[model samples]
Target: MLNFSATVNQTDLRLAIIECGRIAYERHLMTSNDGNISVRMENGQVLITPSGVSKGRLQANDMLVVDLDGRVVSSRPDRKPSSETPMHLEVYKAREDVRAVVHAHPIFATTLTVAGLEFPVDMLPEVLLTLGDVPITEYATPSSHEDAEVIRPFLKTHNAMLLRQHGSLTYGKNLDEALIHLERIEHVSEIFWRAKMLGEVKLVPPEAQAKLLAIRDAYFKR
Candidate 1:
């Protein structure tokens, strides 16, 4: 039998990805093998889910390990890295602080992308503080380096973004953090969609927005 105790961190990382997969599935954020997830491992390797596999049913042994340059270092014998590995690799290159990334087609957020509408931050304090502003990147074919480049600029300031006519990408320091970012994006997207159905939505005043920023800073600092 393989000695798993020696690879505890890698094992934990794999389990984390599997758990994230189930969470995304349970939340209905990913459907029919439509999303990808990845986590950075020590020594510049990245652990990612395989392509075309259902995220909801990932096994710890099914993950692929790749180097920083996107070369496959290890994986289950017959599995392959996600087709979107380039995109995830790009984010990792652009932000050392981002250790995990989640890309999904949550209906509400994807609807805004398809509608060509940017997610407006002014409507909610929590959205602003938790996600900053979710921008819409220019469209690019999935799994292309060009698509990765399109999202590079937004990665510096925003943890989440919509791919024009596509879906959303969220990243953070860990799997849970990335998932929370996705949740926040989906929540705000739902709010925006509902407000549109109800007609005009009012934004919080600028002064109050500033105060909310102050409160967020205080809490983050603590």
Candidate 2:
């Protein structure tokens, strides 16, 4: 039921996936083999990071292709699809517009969930305008079908989410946008955490927030 994008050179997409992983690792969005990245192909298959490989050092050939059903379509003989494939597949199944997904254990974002601290997203205009509200999914065992189920309700309304006591999930029309969403989550979390330590943090005025949401809605419409 998903409408795939136009044809894109698979090799280039593989390289893009590699770059996303490296940047994420370098930025500390994820550490070691802590995260997964996937990009949907025009043919409806997905290019994803291989299991057990350090994302920072991923090679183009290390990527695997899998159908929406989470079966491997193409991959090196020695490679396996990410263990989190079910989570990625659910994303594509539930949202056709999502072309890429980035799941990472960002320190601040994950810490927010671990500490059970609420993120006042409306306090930041950039967050309100770009990401709206990022909801936290109930705790689900990692890499399981439950992971998919827990995030299902949030898919329709949010492009970014916090996994209870785990990490974050973000997706967009492309990998860059998805990565940016992950970054925004960590950035906003760190800011809110720091502000809470400094003292009580004031929210954006309600009237201004309404205006920002209007702009956000108009932008998303295009």
Candidate 3:
């Protein structure tokens, strides 16, 4: 059986996930039960959304608790873990810094992945500083270990990535940071599509890009 002491702030974390779900839904980032979210609790248990449930309607009780090894330690008796749990587990396994993982199918980002177009790193400074180069992992069947393995390499250097024909996965030191990365990816994808409509795209100079990264690093360190 899984073992851990329940933390006091779980209610707050669950509410945060619920609020994020509503925002993602209202923005049309996820439809029906299309996305999943997970937050690491103080006790090493992960609080995650249940499978097949509409994210917009989730309540605090809808969260499930599982250990790092993916063993269920606690949950509402009726709720099951998200189908994408393994992907979240793989991320936690690969990066000690990540405390939350979000999987969403925002229209613009998913559309680019569906069309096999990569987000141009040279087009946006925010994307460079916040997300780095968002790589596309090779296609793998969803809810499978194969899917997690394909993204393992990029997870170390990137906070966000497109899952080939699937959707997008983003991680961070906490839930809010991860959500910010997802929001930025969606915005950048939108800009890329708009630029395509106007004419040929323009890119930031390589030297400028390096400066942007340096500035971001310095800001974060301080």
Candidate 4:
């Protein structure tokens, strides 16, 4: 499991969830009601965004708490758990270190998926150090049984990925980190897309890439 330097409580987590949902919305990561966010509590209950709710106006009380088995542990009719809860559940099941996840529909990232492109994030030092290779999950119907499975294999090694024909998924030890990745991916995607329009973009040489990765490993060692 991710060892948070500080213990995360339900109230704090709930607040973070609301704040990040707004961040996602304001950043245009998704249409107000398009994505899902979740945080795994210490007690194993999953707290998540509600279905069809506009994240811009989402509140703490508007969240739902569900068990790992996908059963509703605590909920309010005003806010029901998202249909994509299964996808978030699969992520927690696959990685004990992950405490929070952000599913967004950032335009640039989705554009890459639609164009059959994966962000060559390694081309930039900041991106190479913060995020390595960004993967794209196999195409699957959104919120379908296969959707979560399409990304299951990459969970162990990747912190973020593009969901084919869908959008993006980013996970981290907390909502703050998760949101950071959400922003970073979109920013990198835009850079790569804009750069390639002018001419062939240069890649970091293999020798230089190895050194940067070594530095990244040292800084982000789990």
Candidate 5:
């Protein structure tokens, strides 16, 4: 089991954050300094990416440790947590089960939001089972407490959301799951976009969608 004591060394968590950043950047989920990733330590502190740094180039030491209230507990002298820290902290506070959060401006997903489109929840069984009904949060000022408030209502029912005219936010029991959710969001968006370009997009039957949802709920129990 992982340690969560006040004195627990954060080396592993920092490395995980760094790797997540690198993967996100490489996969084009985030570019430049357009995204943030965080993992809540077992002790209730959070390790997050620093501000204004390319996620693809992040180093483990660039991670900042902060309390749930957004107070810095430890960080490199030159580093500061991402400006959207409140948004990340909100997920941790609202959903005790969420240990990691990822926010990114993925191309396809953000495009859907910019066009004011919602994910077709029953169009694909994989998406329905894995992500459920992806909600689009009302537009909120970036890096503000409003970002937190807008997403709070969906916290109990959704693991992934598209930020209106912004990007996407996804969280899970760990960094891996969170990242997977991020990737899946973009993947489904691209598929939907491509399908529209080809022809009418087919959807699973309502009966099948309901069955998949029941299975998903029973399995995730979220």
Candidate 6:
């Protein structure tokens, strides 16, 4: 699998952000001007999606470089960092291991958030192995400090979460993993929704859950 970690230059990082946006759009995870993505660079700077643009339509030059304090560090005519810049910055500040952050509003994940369904646990080996628990942040005004604060507690334990009534957030050691986790949440939500329609969702037993988690730990190490 091609991953952004193959990158070693500034150009590669910029293009990776564009790829993240395109992948989100292709998967129907974003539309219009609805999503945000960011990368914390090796130099300790940040590259983020500009405000008020479609993620699908983003070009390499559309990215903005900012400092830890959200000050623009690069030149741009009209583009500023994403309004959700605070949210991305907070994740990076809180999770030292997270290098990339992605926020998108995929159908099933957002539907589950809007309908108040918590992310499932032990219902499927894949869900448990991929994400132990997808936390749901309390609803707060979007693009505000209040929204950022709601997710503060989950950063250490989760790689993905549903942002109450707004969208979903996923972060990782690299852009590919971050984007994959976002997609994984949506896929898991869809699977559970369909299974519920068939009957009550079948959950994996505790013993089986432990074994699957062990396997997941080994797999993640690779």
Comparison by TM-score, 2 against 4, better one: 2
| Candidate number achieving the greatest lDDT relative to the actual structure | 2
Misplaced by over 4 Å in model 5 are: 1-9
Superposed model 4: Cα runs more than 4 Å off: 1-6
Arrange candidates by lDDT, descending. 2, 5, 6, 4, 1, 3
Better of 1 and 4 by TM-score: 4
TM-score preference between candidates 1 and 5, better one: 5
Q: Write one digit per residue (lDDT tens) for candidate 1, span 23-64.
A: 898898999998999988766689999999999999989999
Compared with the true structure, model 4 gives a TM-score of 0.94
lDDT for 111 in candidate 4 is 93
| lDDT at 108, model 5 | 95
lDDT value, residue 216 of candidate 4: 87
Cand. 5 TM to true fold: 0.93
Model 3 misplaced regions, further than 4 Å: 1-8
Give lDDT tens digits, candidate 2, residues 1-222. 112244667877888888899899999999989999999988889999999998999998999999999889889999989889999999999989889999999999999999987656888999889988889989999978889999999897789999999999999888888998899889989898898899998899999999999998888541
Provide the lowest-lDDT 10-residue window in model 2. 1-10
Candidate 6, poorest ten consecutive residues by summed lDDT:
1-10
Error of 1 at 216 (Å): 2.6
Per-residue lDDT of candidate 6, residues 1-222 (tens digit): 216553446688888888889889988999888999899888878899999999998988889998888899994798888999989998988887878999998998889888888888678788778878888999989988887899998888888889999889999988888888888888888998999889888789989988998988988632
Worst ten in a row by lDDT for model 3:
1-10
Q: In terms of TM-score, which candidate is strongest?
A: 2
Winner by lDDT between candidate 5 and candidate 4: 5
Off by over 4 Å in 1: 1-8
TM-score, every prediction: 0.93, 0.95, 0.92, 0.94, 0.93, 0.94
- The C-alpha lDDT values of all candidates are 0.85, 0.88, 0.84, 0.86, 0.88, 0.86
lDDT of 4 by residue, 1-222 (tens): 122333788888788887888878998997859999999988878999899998888877989999988999888866668989989999999989888998999999999889987778777888888878888989989877787889988999999999997899999888877888889999988888888998898888889989998998999654
